[model samples]
Target: MESYGFIDCKDPKYVDTVKAIERELLFDGLLFRYKNNDDFGEPKSSFTVCTFWYINSLFKIGEETKAKNLFDQLLSNSNHMGLFSEDLDFKTKKC
Candidate 1:
């Protein structure tokens, strides 16, 4: 499987494209939902992977403060056992 950001052949525009996609995923709700259309045309109720990706992307883009904020948000999604399962219900604010 090809990785999203891996570039075996260095293209001058590669980094720019990756950064643009990352920013869009982080900030554009419409694009995010559209990309994950399989999950009810949006994200699942609990999405640890998505949350983690957001944090990772922030760090990759040199936004340490923003990355920390996203990290805190992901941590907040943990359950009573300090563990995050598969889904987080945004409406109920529970995982």
Candidate 2:
């Protein structure tokens, strides 16, 4: 909803919904896409794409400073080769 400009952050409902989404999916500041339902069953970790999406949403919600800080943290989690897999370890800052 945030990506396609479907959400108007100025509106209270959109803000409430996004906040609820964030509250439900955010894990230790990282965003987890969803609960286990995939063929793989349970989730092993948070998806990197979701992290980017979360950051973008933060920007939309007027949290630029927090978004930038999280963006930096996300970059720091890249592997030594500057490579990223689908999943990242938030605690270790590694992929």
Candidate 3:
């Protein structure tokens, strides 16, 4: 599914609904699961997908510097092979 721009979470037709959901996810810091009643609850740091989305969002909102910083942080999370895996440990700084 398309996660970027006005299709899934940012649809204009559902602007209010989208914004509300985004607000909850972005500000309220909620982590949702793929299936119903399967929440992992709050997390200390952002997830891989969310971090990528944040970098994209920063670029989309014209915050290039911030986006670059975020990009660097995300890059630093990569393993020695320069690849990201399904299980990444941001704390230990390993993948």
TM-score per candidate: 0.58, 0.76, 0.52
lDDT of 2 by residue, 10-77 (tens): 67776676687688887776777787578988665788888887788778778899889988978877
**lDDT of every predicted structure (CA atoms):** 0.55, 0.77, 0.51
RMSD of each: 4.8, 2.3, 5.6
RMSD of 2: 2.3
Rank the models by lDDT, top first.
Answer: 2, 1, 3
Provide the lDDT at 67 for model 1. Answer: 74
Q: Write the per-residue lDDT of candidate 3 for residues 1-95, one digit (tens) a residue.
A: 23534365343444454344355544222222221333554443334566566556556545579679757867877787888754344355444
Lowest lDDT sum, 10 consecutive residues, model 3, at 27-36
**Candidates in descending TM-score order:** 2, 1, 3
Per model, state how many residue pairs clash.
3, 0, 0
Candidate 1 per-residue lDDT over residues 1-95, each given as its tens digit: 01465552135354465467566554422113224667356664545566576566546656679679768766776788888766556555466
- Which residue segments of model 2 deviate by more than 4 Å? 2-5
How much is the lDDT of residue 31 in candidate 3?
21
Worst 10 residues of 1 by lDDT: 26-35
* Local distance difference test, candidate 3: 0.51
In model 1, where do residues sit more than 4 Å from their true spots? Answer: 1-5, 8-46
